[model samples]
Target: MEKERGYNMQIPEIQITKSWRKSISMSFDTQGVLQVRAPKFMLSGQIDNFLLKNSAWIDKNFQKITQRIKNKKKYLLWRELQNLETISDLEQYFKQEAKKYIIPRCNELAQKYWFTHAWIRITSAATRWGSCSSKKTLNFSYRLVMSPVECIDYVIIHELCHLRQMNHSTKFWKEVFSIMPSYKIYENHLKNEGWKYTL
Candidate 1:
């Protein structure tokens, strides 16, 4: 009877025009909106009843989905700032802030969306802005310090999201986008400034 919070349930009612010769699947999204995969001959009323019968499961899975998004973890990784004497003190400071601020912010964002995972980390990576290993260790590039706080958070959260998802599937992006609507802007910011940097 109560509506779900923290998630929008705008599931466009799907109209089936195609035929399926096999069995079908059905479920609701994390937001508690129902979705049914049915054959062309299946009655809409039956689908509706099926959804009604599974309301409790729908609610539970929806919460689970939200947790899967918000509970993502970050893994910090970076040994001593090694023999790159060519790097300036200011650059080193930036790298340090990147490690510090990025990790906490990512953790907060993960909680907001209901994602939980094992670890978080920061690193001096060149090509990769961030990475989420299968082991759940999140790796963020030290170069994130070069960008604004918003851009850095975007990258950090993006990597943290990979803890729940391994690929760039629609669901993965959905989880990422749900957490940071402004994520796209940060992505563009990275691209524009990417050429300016030596890396």
Candidate 2:
């Protein structure tokens, strides 16, 4: 069964593309890379797997992307599972133990940028970092506590910007860049390491 996601974490998902006739292998790298083994005929792109930033073609065929990822296995190693206690320090930390360090930074940046966030919720879903609804409620995945702090900040700022602009229109990105000039770098960094956890 899938583990429960904590209030501040989300699992990172990766896209895998292969011929409908071929089988593929999806695995994470030690440095936290999302690797998809497939036939060359079907090329794959590693993205945040949350919302694709470039949506010209994606928006029209969104399901096409979402439907392709491999499903999570019914069971996982206790150590690989996301929770409060680490397998190593099974005695001391929870899988999402890292969130304690992330939420405050998110709030600080949101306040710094003038977002009227009603509350910050943390979770451990492997597919998303942060999300903002029209209600002004923010939801974050605890998996982020494992990522670099810069990446954590980027997701927070990205979602927080959504409070002002809900879509990825040029203006929305402008807001993201206003607060994070190196947003792209951190985005790539997240993509590079984000898919280790299965959602």
* Model 1 lDDT tens row, 57-79: 66677665555434221111121
TM-score of each: 0.51, 0.53
Error of 2 at 138 (Å): 0.9
Superposed Cα RMSD, model 1: 17.6
- Stretches of candidate 1 off by over 4 Å are 1-91, 197-199
For candidate 1, the 10 contiguous residues with the lowest summed lDDT are: 71-80
The candidate maximizing TM-score is 2
Angstrom error of the Cα, residue 92, model 1: value is 3.2
Per-residue lDDT of 2 in model 1: 86
